[model samples]
Target chain A: MRFLKECKADATADLVYRVCPMHLLEPRELIKDLKQGQVLEILTDYDGALEDIPAWCAKNGQEFLGVGEDEEEDFYKLYIRKLH
Target chain B: MKRVYLDHAAATPVRREVLEAMLPYFSEFYGNPAAVYDLGAEIKEVLEEQRTQVARLIGARREEIVFTSSGAEANNLAIKGAALANQKKGRHLIVSAIEHHSVLNAARYLEKFHDFEVTFLPVDQYGLVDPQRLQKFLTPATVLVSIQHGSNEIGTIQNLAELAVVCRTQGVLFHTDAVATVGQVPVEVQTLPVDLLSLSGPALGAPKGVGALYFRDKLRLVPQIHGGIQENGRRGGTENVPAIVGLGQAAALVQGELDAKARHLSRLRDLLVAGLQERVPQVLYTGHPVQRLPGHASFCVEGIEGEALLFMLSRQGIYANTGSACASKALKTSPVLTALGIAPDVAQGSVVFTLSQDNQEDDVHYLLEQLPPAVERLRSFSPVWRKKMAAVAGA
Candidate 1:
C-alpha cells in the first residue's frame, strides 16, 4: 500500500501497468507486491473493484486504483503498477 | 445514430394523441367518477365511452371490459377466475408450456392451493402449439384452455381462431393472453371465436397500469380482486380514467394505422433480418417465417452468451433483449426458447429484437455493425465454445 502511494505521485512517470492474471492473485495481495515508484495493476472482472480498489487506496494512504473491461473475459487485463 | 430501441415489446412511448387525451383528465376532469355531481358524472361518462371504444376494438360488449392495473393482473384474473367459478364444472385447466409467468404461475397457484388439475401443452421447434394436442388434453373434467395469441419472446403468432373453434366445438371455454397482439395486430373476438381474452395498454401506446380482459356475455368469471363494486361490478376500484382514456385514443390510432404500421415494420424487419444473416454466420434465426409479428426478430448466435452480448450492445447504446423483455440481461435461460426444443447453449445465446415503426435502415446497419465483433470477442474467451471449436477442428 505504501509503494502504491509513491508511484501515483511520480510526476515524470508513465503508469507502469502490472496486470495480475485473473486467477493468480487477488487485487489487495497484488497491490502489496509493487515497489514505491512502480504501479500496481489488477486483473479483475468483478465490477466492485472499480470503486473498492480506489476507495481502499485512498483510506490506506495509497494511490493505486481502478479497473477497465474487455469483451473477452480473460483478456480483461486490469492495469495496475507500483507508483506510490 | 446514437442508439436504437428494439425493445418495443417491453413498453412503448405514449403517442401524441393519447398524451393529449390524458393530460386533461389528470387536471380538469380529475374528480372521482363515484360522485353524482356534474364534474364527476362527466368524467364517469368519458370513462364509460372509453370502455365502449376498448370493447369495439376487441369485438366484445362494453360491459365485458374489466380494466385492471396490468397484463399480469388481467391474466391472473382470467385463469384464477375460471378455475374457481367453474370448479363444479371440472377443475381441469390447460395452458401452453410457454405462457407468460402470469399464466403459468396462476395455474401453479390453482394447482397448489385450490384443488385444480393443470396440464401444460408443449410447443414444437418453431414455438407453435398444436391445436390437436390441446384437444387431446380436453377431457370431461376440462374447464378452460388458455394460450397466448402471440408469444412475447419467440414472436410466433398462434392461430387463435383455430384453437377457439376446437374449444368451442368441444364446449370448452377458451382464453388468450393477447397482450402482445391487441393493438399492433388485428384481434377480433367475434372472429377469433375465443370466449375470453386479455390485452394491455402499454404494449401499444397507452400508459402503463391499465389493461383489460374481454369476456363473452355468457362466460362467467369470478373477480380476482374484491373491493368496491366497480367496472360494472366485474372489477372493483376507481377507474383509471386517464389511462383508460389514453388506451381508447391509442386504440383508435392503431385501428387507423394498423396496416401502414404493419407494412413499415415488415419492411424494416426484413431489411434487418437480411442484413444480419448476410453479416453474421453461424447464427440461427428463430420464430415462424410467415406467421410472425412484423417487427420482431430473434436470433441464436452460435458461440456468445446472451447477457455478455447484451452488455456489449448496451455500451454501444443499442437496446435489445434475449427472450422476453421482462427476463433479459439476468442471464436466465428463456423458457419459451427451451420449450421449443432449443438446446441449452443456443437458448442461452438467443436474443430478441422487437422494433417499433420509428426504427429505420440506419438502426439495422448499426446493429449489423456492432453484433459480429461482439460475438467474436465473446467467443474468443468462452472456454465451452473454444473446446467445441477445437474438437471440430480436430474432426
Candidate 2:
C-alpha cells in the first residue's frame, strides 16, 4: 500500500470525485476543474482504477500522493495533488 | 445473509445431476474421442449418446447436432459459417435487431469483412420481430434469416414457427439462437421449421463452455474452425467430453421435467412481477406480459439508476441483472431496450429477474420486501428522480 503521508498532512482535499466504474472519462473531466496545488481525492468502486489513477496522475504532471481503502470491499480512496 | 439469485438467463448453477454425470469424464473416462483405441471408442460412444440425449430435448436427430464451446460460438458458426458457405447462392442476410451480440457481431463481421449485406429487422415494443416487417427485408438474394428464440434482457419469446414459415416460403434458411429459450420453453425442431438452432449448456443447468448447434439434415455449412475432422469436419477442436456429458444430463432433466419446472418458474416469476408492481411506483413492465419466458420478470423504474439499484440489491444479498454487462462500458441502458423504443432515461433503470425451477415464492417475497426501499434509497442520489419529484411537487 502507498501510505498517504502527504494526504495525512493535508487532511482536506479541494475536490472529491466519485468515480464510476468503466466510465473514468467523467472523473478525468472532473479533475480538469481543480487548480494547481489543490488536492483531489477519488473514491471509486472499480478495481481497475486502483492501478490506473496514479499512472494517469504522473502522465498529466500531477503528484501521486497515495491511496486508501474504504470499509466497503473493492471500494478505494485515492489521493492526488495537482502540479499545474 | 439470505441470498436470492434471479439471473438465470445470464447463467445458472450447474445442477447436481449434471455435475454427477460429468464427474467420471474428468478422471476415469479421460480418453480422447479421436484416438484409435478401446478407451477412445468407449468415450466416443458416450459422447454420441449425449448428443442423442441433447437432440431428443430439441426433437432433432443425433446426427444434426454439432457441439460448440459456447452459444456465442454456435451463433457465430450458424450465421457466419452458413452465410460464407451460401454466399454463392446469395450475399444478403436478415437478423432481428434484438439478437444476442454473438449473432449481431457475426453478421456485422460478415458485412464489414466479406461484403455481405445484412438487414437488421426491427422489433415491436415487446421486442417481438414482426413477420410483416421481416418480409419487407427479404429479397431473392436473402439466403439466411437469424432471429433469437427469446430476448435475454427482456424475456420476449418470438413466434419462431410463424417466422420460420415466412423464411421457408421465401426459400431462405432460418437460424434461431435458442440460448435463452431451448430448455426453458418448448423448442421442438420437428414443429418449428427452422433450419438451424443454437443453445448453450449453461442456460439449461450444465456448466459453461459447452453448447450445441442443430442443423437440419442436408444443411451444409463451411467449417468455422478447421483443423481436425472433429464434429464431422464442421467445427474442428477436441470435444469437451465432461461439459458435454453435463449438457446431456441437463438436457435429459429438462426434457423430462420441463412442464413441472416451467410451472414452478412461472409461479415464482409471477409472484415477483406482481409484488414489484404492487410495491414500486411507476414500474414499467419491459417485455411481453404473457408471451415472455416462464422464468423472466423484467422492469424499468421511472427515475433510478439500474447499476445503483443492483449494487444496493447485492448488498441486501439479492442478485439480479441490469441489462447486458457487455453494454456496461457505454451505459446501463441496453441496445435491446433501445430497440424496443424505450427512452434512454427509462432504460437506465432496467432490472431483469430471470428465475429458475429452484427459485421459490419466498425469494420473490424477499425481493419485493427489499427492492422498493433499495429503489427509493438509490433514487435519493439520482438527479433525474429529484427533478421528477420537484416537477411533481410544482404540478
Pick the TM-score winner. Answer: 2
Which residue window of length 10 is worst by lDDT in model 1 chain B?
B226-235
Error of 1 at B3 (Å): 1.5
lDDT string for model 2 (B1-395, tens) is 99999888777899998999999999999999978899999999999999999999999999899999999999998998889767878899999888889999999999999999999898999999888888888998999999999888888999889999999998999999999998888899979989999999988999999999998985767678866657765778899999999999999988978888889988888888888898889899998999988998889998987877888999999999886647644664688999999999999888888898888888888999999999888888889999998999999
Q: Best candidate, lDDT-wise?
A: 2
RMSD (Å) of each candidate, 1 decimal? 27.0, 23.9
Model 2 scores a TM of: 0.81
Q: Which 10-residue span in candidate 2 chain B carries the lowest summed lDDT?
A: B324-333
For every prediction, compared with the true complex, DockQ reads 0.00, 0.01
Q: How does each model score on TM-score?
A: 0.81, 0.81
Runs in model 1 lying further than 4 Å from the true structure: A1-84
